[model samples]
Target: MAEGALFEFLCRMGDNTLVLGHRVSEWCGHAPVLEEDIALANTALDLIGQTQMWLGLAGEVEGKGRSADDLAMLRDAWDFRNVLLAEQPNGDFGQTMMRQFLFDAWHVEMLAALTRSSDARIAAIAAKAVKEAAYHVERSGDTVIGLGDGTTESHRRMQAALDLLWPYVGEMFLPDAVDAAMAEAGVAPDPASLRPAFDARIGAVMAAATLTIPEDDFAHKGGKSGFRHSEHLGHMLTEMQWLQRAYPGASW
Candidate 1:
């Protein structure tokens, strides 16, 4: 892959975690249960920590002076490259679990494949991330199964969550030109190649949960190209970047 393309790819990877971590962090002290509150907080920390590693390496690759903090706390929402799913709002508990399960499954596959990346830096990061991703998947999957198979109200909510989230899942596997180049160069895994496995894993979780995937074929796109985003991102960034943006260059 071209150096610039690779840098962009890394940025997308980092941005996904950064945004999703922020979303999960919103659950801190507000989850439906204390156990889940702590669980989501820890999950958020893992994702944010991954964001630091990925963005720090992106800076190294771009040969820019920017640090992970700069990328995480400075960039505007329009510049972010996370998949639409990652930036999507956390709805009810079921929706949040569904979103986490979907991303966790895909992330595990992506990171596992990335551990074999020709780029040593990428491989090292993926090696560590895969473990965390696996745990995320297990936790999310179990929660989904429990909720879906629980009360009638929970079953309804879980089913609705699955439907709402299904379309966004497509974006995770849509490969662009940059992705092609990186895959060819062994610096990145082919996103499309991860689709079948993603589908299988997701299907298994859904089956255990007794939830049905949505029938809608339409899917949102363009977060990676920065051409499309939900309005939620601006609000999210306003809060996430407040300290850094309000006091530029302020440090502890």
Candidate 2:
């Protein structure tokens, strides 16, 4: 496969974790319970750790001499290749877990596929990330069930979250040129192939949660393409990139 294609694929992987990690980090100290606060913090840390490996490899593949931090903290929104799902705002605690559950379901499958990547580095990174992702899906699924099947208000909010976030889920399985290259090279599975497993996983969890997925079949696109992004990304970039932008060469 072309090196450019590999770099694009890596960016997609790294950017997913990076953006979602930041969103989850926002829950620190704001979760409804102390345990959840800690859990969210750890989840964010796990994702950021995976970000280091993924973007680190991405930078190496690009051979631009950019570090992972540069790719993560210096890039503009239009340059990011994360799916639109990962960038959605964490509306409420229920919404946050719903988003996490949805993404985690997709993520677990993605990482599992990557662990078998033809590229050794990709395989290694996925092996480590898949472990954390397993836990992420489990915890998020439980939270989804707890909130979705709990009190009437919790159930209502959880259902609302599912309705709002479901459209974003389709983007995870949407294939683009970059995804095609990755799959053809055996560096990743065809994005579409992962859909069946992802569906089965989420279906069981949502059933347990008693949450009905939206039947819209309509998905928001553009984030992975880097041709378009939601307004939320630009705003997020301002805060996420500010420190690095303010101090160009500074580092810890």
Candidate 3:
């Protein structure tokens, strides 16, 4: 954490929600059931709402006069700070829910810790957000459990999803300089510090679902650091930012 550590940390928070919200929104009308479609849509809306608050604060902290929309739509892939997991493709309904459950587990813990952040604004935002996050985790956990313990086909797909997702889980808990500074300042917990709780939460759900965690703990990195990004994210940004980039400043 150096001169712009807070700005960097804020971007990481905002970018996670912004990117994941877009990913979740992709399920709007394509969900397997009408109930699921509506639920996913609402979940996407909640994530995007959280994005506005996080990015709004990021923009303010940066003092470069960029708005949330600018940070989200104006920047290219390498500028993003979301974990690699958030940008991963939605393979199937089962995969989608699996991704949601994993992230939701970490999210609930992260937001709960933020509720007591030394920064009042951060604490306030987390206080409001923790409520939505709680529901998100519970719903996702139930879905994971249901599909994991369901019929053979359902269980097979869920197990596959869990394997694909588990590797990415490590990145969320990997601490960096920004995290150290945030923790030191009492603004946020070190990402690593959240891992034990995340592990316990997921372990129980996985056991109920009867899914196995992958053997190798190989974690991908660089997305949050802006050093590198997966090919998927560049493509995602092309669509998400197209409207903003094509017609700069166009708005209702």
Candidate 4:
């Protein structure tokens, strides 16, 4: 049971990275500037690479016949364990930056905590990923601050992106049964414990960006716990899973 739960937990992490990576990769040819385009694409590659590592580990933990590709490409939208924040549509450059910033902030905190995980594999993966996630957080945070403080129009767009993406941010810190079990088992970090660090990092970035944090009177939650996601997830899964669905066992 512990191993099964661990596999599920790892898959959830991988799925979030995979889906968000796919969304960000869509901007490669469409970014507003060449440098920004290259950066976004590189970031997407890093995230997808991380996903592959996590998913492969998950497959091993599961002790099942499923390969990493099978777990990623064969899963339907309902079966995916990714958060809604990852599936939310990338509205504009500002929106994309905001989305990435939010996730990167959470990831940095999470990975830092996971470095202490009792599970050697989890700790090792986190140790390696923390460096990358730290850079991701810094880059995205810088982008947020630049756009938010750049000009009237840029500020407005950045503010709007923050407002739109804020609701989904809550899910990152909301702990679930799996999280509780993992925390108890020492296989994963308790997300709740990471909240303070996440908040400090996010608050500093928002302040530097000259952006106000959104009010949380009604925080939207329920993603990793397996609730349905935003409408965009279905479309994303269609594109991502189509080849595997259409041609079972097909590969280069």
- Residue 194 shift from truth in candidate 2, angstroms: 0.7
Let me know the TM-score candidate 3 reaches against the reference structure. Answer: 0.98
Every candidate's CA RMSD: 0.9, 0.8, 0.9, 1.2
Candidate 1: which stretches are off by over 4 Å?
Answer: none
CA lDDT of each prediction against the hidden true structure: 0.91, 0.93, 0.92, 0.88
How would you encode candidate 4's per-residue C-alpha lDDT over 1-252 as one tens digit per residue? 367688879988899899999999999899999999999999999889889889989988888777789899987777788888998988999999999999999998888888898889888888988898999988999999999989999999999999888888878878888888998988778787888888898899899999999877355665576677667888988998888899999978
The TM-score values for the models, in the order shown, are 0.98, 0.98, 0.98, 0.97
Candidate 3 ranges with C-alpha deviation above 4 Å: 1-3
Off by over 4 Å in 4: none
Clash counts per candidate, in order, are 0, 0, 0, 0
Better of 1 and 3 by lDDT: 3
Task: Give me the displacement of residue 243 in model 1, in angstroms.
Answer: 0.7
Ten contiguous residues with the weakest lDDT in model 2: 208-217
Candidate 3 lDDT, 68-108, residue by residue in tens: 98898899887899999899999999999999999999999
Error of 2 at 37 (Å): 0.4
Residue-by-residue lDDT tens digits, candidate 2, 5-123: 99999999999999999999998898889999999999999999999999999999999899999899988888999999899999999999999999999999999989999999999
Model 4: worst 10 consecutive residues (lDDT sum): 217-226
- Write the residue-wise lDDT of candidate 1 on 50-151 in tens digits: 999999998888887989998888888788989989988999888999899999999999999999999999999999999999999999999999999889
lDDT score at residue 204, model 1, on the 0-100 scale? 87
